[model samples]
Target: MSTPTSTDLVVGARPDHLISPHGVLDLRGSAGRDVWLSYPFDAAVVVCGLPGSGKSTLLRAWAASATVVDPRVTRTSFEARMPAWLPYASYRPWARLRHMHWLRGELRRGGPLLIHDCGSRSWMRGWLARTARRAGRPLHMVVLDVGAPEALSGQQARRRLASRRVFALHRRGLARFLRQVERGGQAQVPGISSVVVFDRGQRDRITAVRFGSRPS
Candidate 1:
């Protein structure tokens, strides 16, 4: 929704790499064009992290070749132009409302959807999974493993700090979710075809997001 800031940009990004190979789905009468379709991913891809865990940076890198649905982009844009007197809390609801509306529209249109999540709220995780499933698209999760101190430092660098309480809530939820993932708890999140884990270093190495590149 908003332009990616110079600092909040990924250096490199790439297409989603398939972990489990399978037959392609939903081809509209193409005789021998399999190579041209379903090369990247057929489901929604979500990148999750805490407030300052670099989700926006990654999205910016991916934006060039992918559809990245991020709420912070809009939020930041609004804050940039708003009067200093108006607290973000006053308009926070509207920002969230706009994000939800945009997300719905994007999903409806549907094709290689990419999302940025903060690993909070079980309801949202389930909802996204369900939506992708209903649309016959696989949902993949890219979780960033960042420590609290590091994330907080990132916030300081950005000149924005998330409320302690809110950040704590997100951290707790993320911890539990990550635990499940480590234990091979696939059932924890339904409709997830694969989970790609990334750390700060790995994320920094990304530069682009392509949608039709199959892995060899």
Candidate 2:
């Protein structure tokens, strides 16, 4: 496995695929916490959070088994193809379109997929929901609820930044989804079987992402 970057602030999540004590906020069998005794194992999970919100870092450490659909790969590729002097702001739209095109193709694949969500739009989730329904697969979520300031910290740590307007848009959309969850849309949401919310502390505690009978 590749060494995790210094930007990965998570503790106990090492290069090895082992979960250290500092990685899990709730111990197995802890009360009032959702403990995974069994999971579908074949379901796709869409991970949602604001840009620079540590989704990429966390998944880089944990999601070894699943196919990851992260925008960073595309963004990096786009940057490499662009002139060094041209700012990212100049080709943001082209980058987003290309990423979405890739995502749509990935969504057509079978079995388990791990999607890295940037939280700016809901169409992809809706499409995944519909696809899962048709394929008899379920959609699960591992959503990060990091505050705006911490998200900014994460952005700085990664040396990548999102515009304030885009950040505010993501914040609003994710909040709306969380509110819908509060209204008990956990199951009502399209093809979503389970939802897991993690704050910065809880996120740091996450050692790995597994889909079988236990946490990997």
Give a tens-digit lDDT track for model 1, residues 1-216: 221211111222222332221211111121221121122455567878888888877777676666788887779877998898999999998888888778877777766778988967788888887777777667766677667887898899999898999999999988887766555445556666655555565556444455654335
Q: Summing lDDT over every window of 10 consecutive residues in candidate 2, give the lowest-scoring window.
A: 20-29
Q: How many clashes in each candidate? A: 8, 1
Q: What are the TM-scores, per candidate, against the unseen true structure?
A: 0.72, 0.72
lDDT per residue for candidate 2 within 1-216, as digits (tens), equals 322222212322223332211111212121232222223566677777888778988778756667788877889999999999999889989998898777666666654578898644677677767876766666777778887899999989988788899889999988887666656444435566666556776666666666554225
Candidate 1, residue 59: the lDDT equals 76
lDDT of 1 at 158: 91
